[model samples]
Target: MKRYLLAGLMAVATSAIAAPPQPLASADVKALVAPPAKGIKVLALWSLDCAYCEENLTALRAYQRQHPDVELIYVATDPAYQRDALEARLKRAGVDDVTSRAYADATPDRLNFMIDPSWGGETPRTLVIHADGSRKAVSGALTPARVADLL
Candidate 1:
């Protein structure tokens, strides 16, 4: 009975540690880009399979450590069902503590269209939303210098 109890407790603890990613809707993405109460907002869109996405995330994580005042939002382009992988990637990137969202819609094209009509569904997309709500969107990985400039 003690062994069973320990196994159950272990399962519960593992589940808590592997919490699923939050579902991201079109409106959610829009809200992220909205004018913030203070400091600049950085929206980073990435996927688990993209190599450049990992590089961008690493750069962003370092930038976040330096500029904690900046609001960092990480949007995972992978489908919501792959939350486990997405969560693992975020943890590896050192951004597991930040606000994170995953693509909820099964049809990614619709979600892509909703996020940005001109996005072309690229990974490692970065958007710098200024305090005034004006945004600059860049598709592809961002270098450390560019990340610093964005902040």
Candidate 2:
């Protein structure tokens, strides 16, 4: 019983050390969309309340594992106040290692517009940005094949 308790404590401590999602403002969003120095950058937008977001996150985690060189950025569409919930979901998905951010602006609509003028404010939205700053945006849950094709 003591050994089990010690192991459980250690696990909890390890998880606590994992970085939590940062707050994302409109300026941050603009910076995120910029092209990377090398390799492709994947921006995945999700929400704790969206059922499809979980599935998409799982697929993204698997894809990241397969292609370690790809840059994966996860942005939780939930308000900044729900940071705890967003972090919990990211932990559950085993994706806390990736760069994570939560929408922080009071006027999220404006932020959404900045992200993409045509986007319908949907969860599970994905943007595959190339090194040249060009990108393809997809709105919906992504499958393994879809992830592969995007990369």
TM-score of each: 0.80, 0.86
RMSD of each: 5.2, 3.4
Model 1 per-residue lDDT at 11: 87
Off by over 4 Å in 2: 1-17
Measured on C-alpha atoms, candidate 1 has an lDDT of 0.80
> TM-score of the candidate numbered 2?
0.86
Model-by-model lDDT, in order? 0.80, 0.85
Tens digit of per-residue lDDT, candidate 2, span 31-123: 988888888888888888888998888898789888887888888888978888888888888778778888899988887778777788898
* Total clashing pairs for each candidate: 0, 0
Lowest summed lDDT over 10 consecutive residues: which window, candidate 2? 110-119
Which residue pairs show backbone clashes in model 2? Answer: none
Error of 1 at 3 (Å): 29
lDDT of 2 at 30: 72
